[model samples]
Target chain A: MAEVEISQLHKTYPGGGRPATRDVSLTVADGEFMVLLGPSGCGKTTLLRMIAGLELPDRGSVRIGGRDVTYRAPRERNLSMVFQSYAVFPHKKVADNIGFGLAMRKADRAVIQDKIAWAAGLLQLEDYLDRYPSQLSGGQRQRVAVARAIVMEPDVLLMDEPLSNLDALLRLQFRAELKKLLTDLGTTCVYVTHDQVEALSLGERVAVMKDGEIVQCGPPMEVYDSPASEFIGGFIGSPPMNFLDATLRRDGGEAVIEVAGQRSAAPGSWAAFAEGPVRIGVRAETITAHRAERSGALRAVTEVAEPLGSTTLVTAVLGEQRIKVQVPPDFPVGAGDDLWLDLRADRLSCYERDTGRVLVSDR
Target chain B: MTAAGTAAPDRAAAPDAGVDRAPLARRRRNRMLVQVACLAITAFMAAPMYLITLAAFSTRESLNAFPKSFAPADVSTETLRSFLGATGVVPSFLNSLVVGLLTLVLSVAIGTPAGYALARHVFAGRDAYQLFLLFTRALPIVVLSVPLARFFITAGLSDTVLAVALLHTALALPTTVLITASIFTAVPRDLEEAALVFGCTRASAFRQVVAPLALPGIAAASLFTFVLSWNEVLGAAVLTLTNRTLPAQVLGSLQWSPLPYRFAGGFALLVPALIFIFVMRRYLLNMWGTTLR
Candidate 1:
């Protein structure tokens, strides 16, 4: 197993348009589960295809395990991939599908059998070895596809949304299984997925890509909490971070943000940005019900209350703006009634509304 | 819907209504009438063939009889041997086999690649290239055969099996290409991509992955080309006189020639079709599916 380094890769299609994957650079450490997460057409799959050597880059080099394999063919790269469509050979039995690569190298019959058995057993696909892909269910076909790639035991395992076809419950369950299997195998994997939750749960480090470039890359929680920019803050969460326009000021040893109807105290970091109207982002869970008349804060009238059993989602209107809050399930708030939103100044991230950048000190 | 469109399916479906659960007598009679009509048409085609076969095997007296025997009432190998002894019937049969096999090989070699390209590749002249193939296939062989034969004779290739095979390959090229193109299109693009990612080169992926999967189709296409070559008389007759293919040999024979040769020649033609059709039986669904599409 070895780390894969894609340095300044540019993949311009032969038709001569914008590069599908631009000057993108990211590393998948040895035995690291690195997820390339982005929406469709964001170049995640293109990058993975380049790593697998199925697609060639117009510029830059790809080093796998310290060896430059940029111009090499996929077979020479010693990488196996499980495609999003679960590319199991429809005509072949599950055993045949898993044993195909081994057969290609003309491995010993006993060795091929052992490898097929081992891979099939790991995937819980022993009973279906004799069955064709058309005879198997969606999840079962996907498992066979995974088993086929894993049987090769390549230096790197590339997966392109291998669980996207399964139904909701199956997807979640198989995703957990997939993570465990990858971890147990100790294979370095570069996975591409669009689902943020899947990325968070599967990757040791998630690289968020946009427009053929890596916008942010960090551990799941670090990227979730300390978002580097407005895009990161906007993209990381479920309902997404809510942003409201407010003028910043420092009055008597306290940083304050004054909206149209109320004035709220800010975190200490907001002092450097005490200028004109800026965007303040609050996580849905950050704005809790502040009914006790707590000092050094502001209040907003709750416009809509969505109680989601374990937590309540309250979209409180701050004059012309809307700020979402994830409060305790038992928060005393309802629609049309005024509710207090106690946004802790620390959790409220400030951004330049005009430029859409983080309004924080360099430190 | 227009009256014509509405009535079309109803007219098509009317005959089959007899198979309805507990079909009424009138419906069954209508169905029987349609079946009888179909049977009559089949007989219309097969009757001459049956008569020819009977006249071929029978003595001269049988040829001048009132009506022909439907079955091989007095089947004999005597006429077979006499036909085999006729002006180089054995060599002509072998020549036909050689030409047919050659045609099948060349057409498949050229057509399958063109088919795969047309199916998968998007090139600058792709549509125009396809239109070219369409026009080439639609060109009547009658307009080209005499000139082509003359060209072959001048080139010192006339009356050779190679000349006939080349001519047959040209005739069968478009049909073979179109057949295999439809076949390859049914295969998914993702499968090929997956194979590529697994380290197979484009050609290897095609050979090891796609070609095996498309075997049924390719085989069918080759068989079709083979049949076209075997059955073609016009080009084969003109292109090769000495090493005449079976159809050329049969057509070269005089109208009043021994009836036995007609029976044997017709029987020889029937053999390849029987074999070719049997070979395609497994892929009947494939042909049907293509038709549906």
Candidate 2:
């Protein structure tokens, strides 16, 4: 097990739009599963490739186990990678593909065979070692790609959307299996994916990237509970967080938000906060749908109600603005019905309209 | 979308020919005509090659005694042995092998990498180089031989098999590059990247991964170059005398002695050409496959 330190890493492509990776720095401790999470073209793959030494960074160094390897060749760096395309050797048998690195290192035949057998068994491929890639199914090919990487027993393993090619059922199954395998082998893995749920489920710490830089990096639960910015708040959830345009005013030593011409009185604990037009974001679960309440935030009409089995999602308009809330499926709600919503003040995050910076906490 | 759709037909009114016909009979008739024409062309091309093979294997008596029969009455080793005798034939035959091998080696080493660079890497004057190679190939050998022979004489390279081999390589380069370039195109660039990510160095990646995969097409390209060198006589005759290739030796003596050995020598010269074509038939089809795709 070995930690990776990428210090001030920058990659400027030949034909520049911007730096593909702009002064990004991150550290992963030994045995930590860190996922570089982002949408397509966000430079997550470039970061992983650079860390693998398959790509060279323009202006910074990548160190593994405290050894600098920015200019090292892939073999010299000793990191195994599984590509998004499942880059298994199509011309080789499963056994040879898995044992490719061992063969390169001039390992003995018996050792290679035993290692190949162990990897094959770990991936549940006892019967297909002699088969070519063209003869296998998509899931099997993915297993082969993973098996090939793991058999090398390198210091780190970089996986670039390794399950993106598999079917949904197979992806879920393999994701769990891969997590277990990495844990058992005690290899540091840096997984890259755009799926936030996959990052949450797999990564011990998820680093959210956008526009060639990491905007937030934290434990998955920490990132889920307290997003750092408006972008992160809107990006991390399934139905996403609800944000309504509002103006904050200081009145009688409390912060009051005027949303859609209706003033939402703050809880008095947030009285010393900023006072101006701002955007208020609340997660879907934080906005509770009730008939009417005396102590909480607002009264509104439920515009659209969707009963999604165990939980229900209701899109409600607080005056001129619409927001979504998760409630019980059997909650009394339907389209064009009036309802009351108790906005949880402690869980609320307010962002400045001009800056989009989260003012709730240093999250 | 409607605005864009109207642009194609606004200039004309008589548009009956543009509509697809719905009748099955017309389509079937057109298909049948195409099939029959295809069959006729296939048989037309097959007939000459079939007759040539019959004549090549026929005995001297059977070849001379008739309205040429499709079935020769006799086939013997006497004519084969005489055609491969030591006095002149064996030396010339050995010369053909050497020239073909040299031509194959030289052309392949230069052509495949040139093709890859053309297909992949982009640099200034690349198109100019390609056009230059094409122009070199388009010049007929007989036209260039006059000036080339003078240059060879000046360099003291007169009457050598190497001179003829170099001339043949120049003739084969354009086809070799074009074919191998198309073959490399069919194999994905991702596979090359995959090899690099594995433990291979850049050159080792090419040697271990890309080379084995490109072998069939390279084999076909080398085969074509060898055959072209073997069957070449016009330049070979001008370039060499003591080490004349088989085609040069045979073509120079074609009519002076109409002995059985003469006909047999012609057959012997034709044999390797036929073998090369047969060996590369599948890959030649693959070349077309890759081209169309």
Candidate 3:
């Protein structure tokens, strides 16, 4: 395994109006599982391809294991990649596909056979060694692709949305196995995916990207619990974080904010922004709901309730703004039912209205 | 009011179901008539081949009799032996085989890489070049043979099998390029890229992964080019005088041959093409049956 360093990387197609990736830089430590996550066309895959030497950058350099490899061919880079299409050779048997890299490197025949056997055993593909790729299912083909990359035992492994083609159940099952496998091998990896769940589960450090730039990069929980920007807040969560416009005000020596004509004391960090317009971001799970009417709570009528077994998600409207609140599934609620939602002060994040950057917190 | 108005039509239409049977029967009869017409046309096109084979195998007496019998009276080797023993006939047949094989090699060797580039790369004037290939199809071989004959004479290549083969390559190249390009396009690009990432150079990737997958398409194109060159008459006749392809020699000497020899020559000329198709049928099936997925 080796550390990878990229600096000031930029790439643009010949006739593209905008660069696919611009001024991007990142460092992945040895054996680190760094995931590049964003929506489609967000340049995550482009950055990963640049690191793999499959794509050349317009400007900037990449260094792996302290050696500059910006202009090296993909084969000379000694890096392996699992394509999103699971590009295992359809004409080759599974064992040959897994041993292809080894054969290219002129490995001993015994060693190639041994490695193929180990990979097939690890992937539970022992019975399929002699079968061509066309005979395998989608999940099996993806496993073959992984086996092909891992058998090389390269210093770095790159995966681009490898699980995106599998069905949801298979994706979930394979992702856990893949996470275990990567950890076992301890190979430095750069994975690109648009799936938030996969990013959260698979990445040791998640780099949230947008418009060819990194918006946030940190441990998954840190980036999740404390997103750096409104875009990160919305992109990282399921039933994403809710945002509401409010103006800070002073009431009886304390800072307060009003929502749907109901006023509540704001966190003390907002004292400087009294009478300033700010956007509040609250996670759906952080919002508490009470069946009985309570004081200092925003009154709303439930518009939709989705029961997800243990926790029910309730989407409701307070005045003109809509908010999603996750409550206990056992809590009785229906469409048009009046419910009171309490936004926890500690769980709320405030951002400047126009800039969308997080408001400074004193803690 | 609209619901009540629509309900009345449903009751009125219930008794009209029997009226549909007559049209259905008529449609079935019409389909049967079309099938019979197709069968008749197929038989009409196929009958000449059957009659020619019968005549080629019949005894001279049976063939020349006043009452011409359509059936093969008796299987005889005398007529075939006479044609095979004719001076220069066997040599012409060998020349046809040599020209066909040479043309197949030249066309594929030059066309495969051009087809690959057309299928894979984006270069300036690529679309225009492809259109030009298609446009060449409109030019007749007779028009090209005249200029080719002049060039061959000046180069001292006239009356040689190589001369005929070269002309045939020019005739077959456009079809070869278009067919091989489409075939190469069907082989996925990702497989080659995958090989490259697995420690192969670009050339090795194509040799190891792509060529094997595209073999069926290549085989089909080879068979097609061979048959085309084997059967071409105008270019073969114009380019060669002494070293004639079988078709050219047979047509040139048609008046001098006896009736049995003419029939035998016609049947003999078809033998190699039939053998080529028989040998290549499997590859053709693979090419058109299941697409590369």
Between candidates 1 and 2, the one scoring higher on lDDT is: 1
lDDT of 3 by residue, B64-147 (tens): 887787777788988888899999898999999999999999999999999899999888899999999988878888888889
lDDT of 1 at A48: 92
Docking class of 2: acceptable
lDDT (0 to 1) per candidate:
0.83, 0.82, 0.88
RMSD of 3: 5.6
Q: Please report the candidate that would top DockQ against the real structure.
A: 3
Question: What residue runs in model 2 are displaced by over 4 Å at the alpha carbon?
Answer: A265-270, A291-303, A360-363, B1-34, B54-93, B116-128, B185-190, B231-233, B246-271, B285-293
| Model 3 misplaced stretches (Cα beyond 4 Å) | A250-253, A272-274, A361-363, B1-45, B61-73, B285-290
lDDT of 1 by residue, A1-363 (tens): 889999999998778677788898888899999999888888999999899887889899999999999989888888899999998888789899899887876789999999999998999999999998989999999999899899888999999998888899999999999999999999999999998889889999999888888888999887777666778778778888888888888887668898875788888766766567888877887776776666655667778889889988888777888878888888788888776767777777788878777766854
Backbone clash pairs for candidate 3 read: none
**How many angstroms is residue B223 displaced in model 1 relative to the true structure, after the best TM-score fit?**
1.3
CAPRI category for model 3: medium
At residue B189, give the lDDT of candidate 1: 75
**lDDT for each residue of candidate 2 in A248-278, tens digit (9 for 90 to 100):** 7888786777777766666565566767778
User: What is the C-alpha lDDT profile of model 3 across A263-329, one tens digit per residue?
Assistant: 7657776776647778888899988898779887888999999999989999999888999999998
Better of 1 and 2 by TM-score: 2
Scored against the native two-chain complex, candidate 2 gets a DockQ of: 0.44
